[model samples]
Target: ISLLQDEHELARIVADMPWSKIDVNGLREQETRIRRQIERIENDPELGQLQTELKQLNQQATAENRNQYQAEDDLDKAQHAVQAEQAWLDAYGNDDFDDATLSSMVSNLLADAYENCFGASVRAQDRPKLIAGLFDHESETPFHTRALRNIVRIARTRIQEIDARSNQLRADTERIMDDYLNNHSTDDNTVMASVEDYRYFLDELDELNMLVTRAATDEEYANSVKKLYMSFQQLNRALRTDEENIKEQLNRINSMLKGQQFGPQGGRLSLDVTFSPIDRQFETTLSRILSKLEDWTRNASDNPTETRNAFNNCETFVNRLHNELDKIHDTNGIKAYGARNLDPRVRSSFYAIVHHDNAPDERISSTGGKSGGALQELTSFVYGAALIYLLGGDLTARPTYTTLFLDEALIKADGRYTKRALAVLPRLGFQIIVSAPESKTAEILNVANRAYVAYKDPSTDNSYLQELDSETITQDETQPTTAPAKPTTEA
Candidate 1:
């Protein structure tokens, strides 16, 4: 009864447990199977090998974790170092700092520091040492400070040389200024010496330079004036030569007309040439200018006062010429002097003067009030004379043979006037060839050396020339001479 009570208590405890609902048999079986697996693992050879490999892999993992930690620490340290260097560079770098500029700044700073550190004992060899000491913590290599020392020394030497040269120049400038003041001391031009300051000395030097330049310019102007004066002299000589030639030509023409008599009253003809009143004035002024220019050139180098006076006179004449030219409306004015105004035909008035025994002297201009017959006779004389002048070998001697063509000449003249006209050209040394109609043929044949009659053939339309006998047209011997009536003048 005691054992039964114990069993009954146990059953009651089992029922009151939390896992009392579980199958106790199934749990026992799963535990048995897990036990069997654990036993197999303990006894297998490949399992022991896997365990050994796992042990080694864990050891390797531990070592790899330690190496990774070390690597991360090293990377952090390296990054900090790069950042420190970048920050340092940023402290000194600037946008304006190119390589040359930055190098100069660094050199100056190092030189100053070197000078402060060692003072007079700053040797070239010690420069690199100083550079290294200053920038030892920097990543870049130090500068070659020996070259810097040499540059500084050379710069200082050059500065001293410049100062010495400047002093010499100042002394030379003072000496030259004193010399100039002493030499150029004149009553009209007084040079003051105030060279105490360098700038004042430079100012005085500049003034002297300007004066020298002005003197040179004055010399050049004088040379130009000389050239202009020489040109005027040449022009004057040419004008004189042309005038002489014209006078000679007129003389020749007049000599040819001296003995030749024309018209019923036995009148003589002569040509006259003269410049207009304004042209004469311009010529006179030009002569005066030439004289003044001569005086100026003669005194230009030696006498300043005389040169100035002569130049002023020339200027006055030139101004007068300019004013006159401005007033002239005609292009044929004195401005055209050498070309057109000087031409005898353009500027001068021509008159055919007839001098007779009883009549007053009559001037026949271009618009003459004279009979055509009388004018034609006079024109023949003048034309003959001009031809003789143009045939320019020897004025006194006649040519061997020179032909003068008179086409229908003396057609308007009477028989006496025609005979006189025809006789004049032959006397002036011309072979006369006359072309006159049958009406005047008798008078023309009296003077013509040879004659030919031209006729055209109507059938063939061709022209033919035939010589005619001089005896065909004969002068009448019985024609009585009578005193010519007074030649009527045209209204």
Candidate 2:
């Protein structure tokens, strides 16, 4: 029974084993291929031919082998001769150096040679031949030999003179450079190092020119230029202070805006700026811009470039400061009014809170509460007045058409708040036209210049407006009426 149980377990394992489908016909085809390959090997054509040739070669081996050394020697000699002829043909094939290129090279060499011979020079007819002779004396034509010798003689004399002048010039340049460095940057290691860097830049620029000119293709030239650009950029990285400058400028502006003291009614409106350095990962780009501005500012007068780079830099700094200030929203550490009535809409508005004398440091959500409501209304009134002040000129200095059309004045406010709003608006240079219920009409008319009542005429079923004088409004009970009713004298 145990053996049966073990067999059953083995059967289960086999059943669970991963298996793949097999093609029976494909296996049969592979077998047939193997059989055919075996048969072909047994009757190989090349093997049969080699076997036949082996027998024939063995019979003739002694005779042929006796002359094999001599035959190989002759064959080697013939092969060598063929190789020599091919090499000669290849050596004399179409010239890689074209006439135009040769002439241009010779002209450049002759120009230098002439420059060395004289302080400044002109090209000669024999210059190209003279240079070609120096390179290829084996092919020196009899006609050019005299000119070549004369050129060599002249070059020898000129080279000595040029070497002497070059030594003197080098000494003078070294003296001048030393004097400038000592005078301008003797104590400043940083400035001296920068001067050294400028010298290295000039040296590298000459090398870059050589590299680009010698490059065989446009692609090669472009790559060389890119490499030089990258090398120059390394110096830029060392000299950059854009991030620090920007930070300093922003901090200064923020201090000014924050510390600015306003007169009695400025309402503590101070702008605060905060910077996230991480967001300024584009410091490299900013550095390049600032670097260009610095360069332009330095050479602008001499180079006929615009001198407004200073102004541009100032503008950029101010704009960046503005952006940083914009990112920040002011929050005051005052009381959170209307705490009980904090709704979702009110909660979202908690991003910024207002503080005034009455509701100092109160959450904007407080606007929906009892005392908060009055403050909120007052805030709205002040905000509208501010808009008018901004749109118009200064109220005290110059008069403007400062008119406010208010619909439903002091909505849901009591008499005291209504009366206060009416009193404050006019003093702020606002002529308010208020449309409200008959109850608040009396309060609105107290400060209004000309009051008008809009009503629907019952008989005509059309809306019509009629102006009302303050006396007429005041004569009708303390509150005003939309329209006066007819007198019922007979009744």
Candidate 3:
């Protein structure tokens, strides 16, 4: 038991832990994307086709790269010559170089060029002199020096054009590859039926691969991996927090189940009240009797029949009073009295325990009301059933017998009213056993499991009990036999 309790406590502690929030939607979307990717690869041929195209493009790009390299080499060589001439020009203004050294540099600059270099650089008039000087290894002509600078400028411009062309070609190819790969990775394509139609998919795959390569080089892929790892950590933190909250809630619920004491109050009791038409009628009748009682008291009648009627009326009222009080005792009335710290035994006597502290001019008041009888009984039964539910006794340990004994109850009730009142008993888990005169026997027999009729034997001069069978009762009820004066036992 100790081990179990410790484990439970540990679980609660774990559950109570504060955790982090997770991007559940993001995780779901990622899962869906992966699933779709797998499905596309297994069922579609787009990726493979893109790979083939990418392979072909790779070969073509390789050749193009070689050409670009050559062009770059040429551009480098041209730029070097321009730099050499510019350097010489700048230095010429600062320090004078000998003609032989200048002539040697110019010869070296124009060594690989055609005659166009000399023709373009020097003027037509100075061209012959510059050429003769160069042949004789002379640097006397200033026109030759100017012509050499012009040739260098021309070479630089030509190299720039070559470089631009090479760059443009490379840019176009890279753009095509990037577009293809991006479309494949980011754009959703419909699955095609034909393998031939899968070429578009291959184009996308190629673009995607290229994109991957770029991301890999830039550490973008690593960033994504780190982001995913952090997301998982957050999810775990959230899980821990949620578990702790759940455990705390469970503990609270368990405490409630164990019945927590709130305030100095001990416990609460439930009550159910069911009012009936008979109870209403009784209330009206009692009101009428009270109204007439004052007039009767003022001038008492000498007539015996009137006196008998009064006594019978009083007897009827008293009988109803007993039933009402019994109803209160059986139902929530006792519980209500207990709640108010009133004595149930003392309160059960009168229709309602009245307080007479006020003067005659003041209105009379009572602690309770006259709404009793079947109404109170029904109410109490309902309250009892509700109490059972509130206590969860029905779920834990059901009562063996939910029975109520009402002696001489509802005697004035009609067959319809009686059955209706009885109908609710079973639903409320009540088996009401009512002792009533045989006039109400038919109604009882209709609903009762078994009934007994008591009769005094004339020959033996002894009282005997006989178990009345259901079939005999049914037959006798149809014929409308007079009810016996004595009340019958019902179960």
The best candidate in terms of lDDT: 1
Candidate 1 lDDT over 225-268, as tens digits, reads 67667766775676556655766778888988887886777778
Clashes of each: 0, 1, 15
Please give, for residues 12-115, the per-residue lDDT of candidate 2 as tens digits: 87777665645558879999999999999879999889989999989799778868978998788566656654654575555674547565655666666545
Top TM-score prediction, candidate number: 1
For candidate 2, the per-residue lDDT at 161 reads 86
Which 10 residues in a row give candidate 1 its minimum summed lDDT?
Answer: 482-491
Error of 2 at 491 (Å): 28
> Between the candidate structures 1 and 3, which one is better when assessed by TM-score?
1
Off by over 4 Å in 3: 1-377, 383-397, 458-461, 474-491
- How do the residues 318-371 of candidate 3 rate in per-residue lDDT, one tens digit apiece? 565556555433354443232111122322221211122232222213324433
Q: Rank candidates by lDDT, best first.
A: 1, 3, 2
Q: Where does candidate 2 clash, by residue pair? A: 334-361
lDDT of each: 0.68, 0.53, 0.53
Model 2, global lDDT: 0.53
Model 1 stretches astray by more than 4 angstroms: 1-219, 233-245, 274-295, 298-347, 358-360, 470-491
